[model samples]
Target: MIIARLRSIGKWIVQKQLAEVVVGLFVIVASLFIFPGADLGNLGLQMVGFLVLVVIRLYPGFSVVLPLFASGLWYTGMADHTLLSGVLAYIAIEFAVARGCIIIAVILAIEWLVFGYVVSRDFNPQVEDLPGVLFEFLCFGGAFIIGQLR
Candidate 1:
């Protein structure tokens, strides 16, 4: 019975597209790596939330919702990569669902606004922040391209 269950789980993973799972994991890892000084407590919370989305995404037809929900969660949470993950999630959804560029554009706009206006409020406003901003921009551009190709 255990073997049977495992087989089914394996099948589910294949059907769900392993690329998505890997992308999700990459996002989580990237977030943690980029923000080494982030509060461990908050990072833990975001990791859990992202894991939840990854698990939910394994179900057929559920991929469509996972990205949007993950994005929403990140946007509302204190995670260091909230904006990055949110943008990545939306782009991933575009790749998974083939949603039009317009939707992607809107999501990008919202992310830019939030990252620019809301999320920026947390920073200390120092010249040292320049690196983080540049890192985020690079991540965003790289993620969007990767998502499109994935």
Candidate 2:
């Protein structure tokens, strides 16, 4: 029964939003490769969380909360430690305009600073990895633009 249910769900997702589902999965895999030091268990948990968000994303009315959830995940270090910030940014900017993109970037940056330093108490993680942070930002920015276009 469970297997059949899962299969049906998979079929529905493929039929309705195959590209999105694939991209979501791709983000998970890419994050694993991108952030080698990230905890596997946390990544698994986050993947499950992402799936839930994706489900909400596909829901007509609940789609409004996706960016909120994604940004929340980003701040809490559950958004793949910002290594896959591009994916979250992409999701947030999927249907946004120019002003929305700026808002997303500002909000994401603020959360990254607050949670990464104050909440997680991980001081200076990016201080020495400035280049990496910049690269990730570039990817996130590019993905945001591409998502908006698509």
Candidate closest to the true structure, highest TM-score: 2
lDDT of 1 by residue, 1-150 (tens): 999999889877655656555766777677667766666544554554454345444442443344344344445664444423554444344343322343543344344444544454553356666676676567566655644553
Measured against the true structure, the TM-scores of the candidates, in listed sequence, are 0.41, 0.46
Q: lDDT per model, in order?
A: 0.50, 0.52
The sequence of per-residue lDDT tens digits that candidate 2 reaches over residues 62-144 is 43444345445544666445455445444434423222444544455444444444444443364666675677567556756
Clashing pairs in 1: none
Model 1: residue 68 alpha-carbon error in angstroms: 12
**Candidate 2 clashing pairs?**
none
| Residue 87 of model 2, lDDT score | 56
- Best model number under lDDT: 2
lDDT computed for candidate 1: 0.50
